[model samples]
Target chain A: MTTGQRIDTVFTLFVRLLLAGIFAFAAYMKLRNPAAAQAFAESIQGFKLLDPLQHHHLTVLATFAVPWLEILCAAFLILGFWTRAASFAMLGAMGVFIWAISTVIERGMNLQCGCFGEFSFPCGDTIGMCHLVRNSILAAGCLYLVIRGGGRVSIDRLLISGKPKVERLGATPTPTPTPTPSATPTRPVSSRPASDDTPIALDPVRPTPLSSSPSGVDAAQPPKPRWD
Target chain B: MRFVGRVALILILATVAATVHSLYWPIYRDLPDRQARTQRAPVTDAAAQDGSPTPTGRSELPEHYISVARAYQFWEEGMPFVDARTAAERVVGTIDGAIHLETRNFIDGSATRLLEELDRAFPVIVFCGGGECDASENVAIRLSGWGFNEIYVMHEGYDAWKDAGYPTEAVGGG
Candidate 1:
């Protein structure tokens, strides 16, 4: 790999590990014990996103489900298994957080964010613009991971080593059929365009959405030779 | 599509795991039982001491939910009331002699002093926004945990008491 490509790989790896640590710690603080879980529930109650009296079941579900989701996603992130999917899950969580924080700010309620049990930083305990900004930044990171998939060092790369994106279903390993001069017909086995200068699908199963959610990435850039 | 499938699978796995965890370690394991029971009358024994609140209490007061009429009768007997509504809701008014305690206070222990100074001599009645409100029940359970002898939840809530024209004090001119 070129020096610049190696640097990019390292940076991506760093982000993945950092986010994994953050989510793991958050899950630990919340799920440590029944008392800790209750405390976290109270923190969620502080946000008042739902009425405790009316939406009791939903609130309870959130109390239980959120931490588990965090831990599971963190685990996936750490193993670099289904890394894109894990990033998507975290992105969803961050979206909820951003929405809730904004609602709290709009209501002008002074509430403990209950985000990291009792541990809050930069923005402190009180929910405010800083919290919104922090979550937004994290959301951006998750989006980046989703777009890029796991980096060179990821288990995903190790598992899918010889293939370009995914191997075409039931297709043979053969030289590309001669290119048609008049029209560029569909090449099912082809994961990338012939030229590196042009973008292509990251995976064969899903269309690379050019305009959806900060996904403006060069799709066909060959994976920099394993970042060793 | 594959990414979406993986994401859905992760969420499903997490949700199933969480459901199991919740059953194993309930978040409300420490919560004083606040089930709605119209089973018994308010106990009058002043010396009833159950020590710190536990999930299960031997006192029938935990099962005591009184009607507004009965709550008003207690009020006439000079019983102190606890208002468990949000500060904004309480501004609409509360029972004239009610002490203010909300759910958050229980979590943070900010109302520890207030709870400490309360007169345990009389049975305390707690109320909130009447129908569809569980705040009073919640706060009452906390007070019961703190060794309050006879705790009452006014099930009809504050609106019924106010609409019935009982004594109430409005705050912030609300």
Candidate 2:
């Protein structure tokens, strides 16, 4: 209901859409051209993560799995379904990419990035900081998504019970505690605006409780589920 | 943590789904296998610089790969040289008296006239810009497909040839 909360919602929505569009385009570019798969495979060899000669099958596996994973994660991000999970997946991908590119640079290898498949940016003999900077920014965005759940427009907001209100920087003290699950099963309580009080599907967003931490501050943070 | 576990689950699910889909999707399957292409001869830089001495018995070179020195011998013998580099790349210059047939033009029928006039008995030496450039190998593959048996790929390509102080002709200058 507050102005700061409204701003947070808009910013979160913008980030999710921007990241989703970028990843979707990236996935499509790699998948559209079948020949690019080989180019991608050769680029992977430049990383020196695996010997192309000895572990050819692993190279093939990476070539197929990477772009497909991007598509899957990008789709989830777009729909705002499992937003944090998809963002985490993208973050992991960015981490791997940063490592791979740094390795090539460290070894003084001349290689085409083959990043956007056939539509890759022209990289001459040397790798530069531009690639690193781009991945870093994208990683930051994914990290933000993980910390802040998908905003008002997201499926997570519509479906998850007791979803937290968008937390604005330097906003008022934390809102009231969430009603106990048994106490209000029929009407799930949320800090969201009154206009968003419409009934949502009953299915739990996650298979298990993400965190047993009480609903004030700890619930708004990243999940800390105890593994038994 | 729950975040790590969730991410792991997404990755596992995505990998499994993609593996299954790849079996049928044209995107993941039917990728060009460059490994299946014809094997190329490996010539060390030192060896390429010091091409084998002309053998006494046979007039032709023994290996499909010829070094800078042997390439000169072929030049002295008046064997035809083909420049396999792209037109833009060729604008820098090329081997003196070498013929250029852009690899892309091979399928477009532009090289047919040149193909018909070739001397089958003598070997044709092919070279590109060199230093990880595969244009020469690709051209050699196409030449072999066309039944040109005596084909030699100049291992170090034109860069090595020019670096060795060999005769070269520029596009604009004589």
Candidate 3:
């Protein structure tokens, strides 16, 4: 590999490892006191994005989901598995967290941020500033992955034999084929477009109508076709 | 080899610095104890012996209930009404002339100096969002322990005062 590429690889690896360690520690801290974490969740005024679930149920789910997501993304980042995807997910989560925190601070909420569960860190004015700074750095790191494609040593690179493959599945496949009778003998439809219009128009009569049949003689004759 | 190692080293050092900086702040600071010494009802028995403000011989002190009318009276009389609600709740609405003292620091003794400044005999009413909230009660209890005898818990708090046609104010500034 070129010298610049190798430098980039090393830099990316260091960031991934550092992010992984921080997330792992944060997850552990949150798991320690889920109750306090839940309370902190409720204390925020308008962070009811997960309000589809009942209050405590949402709280419990968040208590588990947030940390686990952090840990999983961190792990993915370190392992370089779907590096860009993982980084994007981590960035999204951090954005939501930053918004939640900023809202709390802007509204002047004095509740503890459950970043480290029951561990009370005084979130004075300085704490908000510090949170923004830290999260912004993490976001920048994630953005680097999104922009530069997961650097070397990533599973994306290793699994694809050095060639990055982009898969595209544009439209859904058609369901089933139904027989469509011709409007006239010469005009036969080959490929029907799958729009709103119906394809089939059944013929009303045959050349030899059913009334001419032997069985038709024994029974009451059927009415002649309107077109005929 | 040297370049890669140097980059790795820098990354590690940066990570360590961030982590250390985040955790290095002092855990908690002890603010001065604000419980008023003179406000405490003089316990005759305790006064006869060691001259601490500790209540003596009184089985139970009266349940200090400061009604909405009384809160209004205090506000009219120029007594500062301290709202013990979280800052967010205060923004929605609060008692006029009430100073915002967050519940977190109310029990932490941060308000000790403020308490010390007030006349021991002067009335200090603590209130929260409403009766459902325990912040006012908690603040009242802490103030009582601080030996403030005239401490009153505005039972219904801001809600009751607002309902009783008393004036309300917007919370901001600090």
Error of 3 at A12 (Å): 0.4
What would the per-residue lDDT of candidate 2 be over residues A204-225, giving only the tens digit for each residue?
A: 3322223453433344443332
RMSD of each: 11.4, 11.5, 21.0
User: What global local distance difference test value does model 1 have?
Assistant: 0.69
Task: Go through the candidates in order and give each one's C-alpha lDDT.
Answer: 0.69, 0.65, 0.54
lDDT ranking, high to low: 1, 2, 3
Chain B TM-score by candidate, in order shown: 0.68, 0.64, 0.59
Model 1 alpha-carbon drift over 4 Å, by segment: A162-228, B28-44, B47-174
Please identify which of the two predictions, 1 or 2, would achieve the higher lDDT against the true structure. 1
Best by lDDT: 1
Summarize candidate 1's per-residue lDDT along A1-228 as a digit string, tens digits.
357767877888888988999889888877776656766766676677777656766766788789989998888888888888999999999999999889889988766676776567777756789899988988998998888777877888766664643332322222333333235444453443332112222333232323222333354432222212
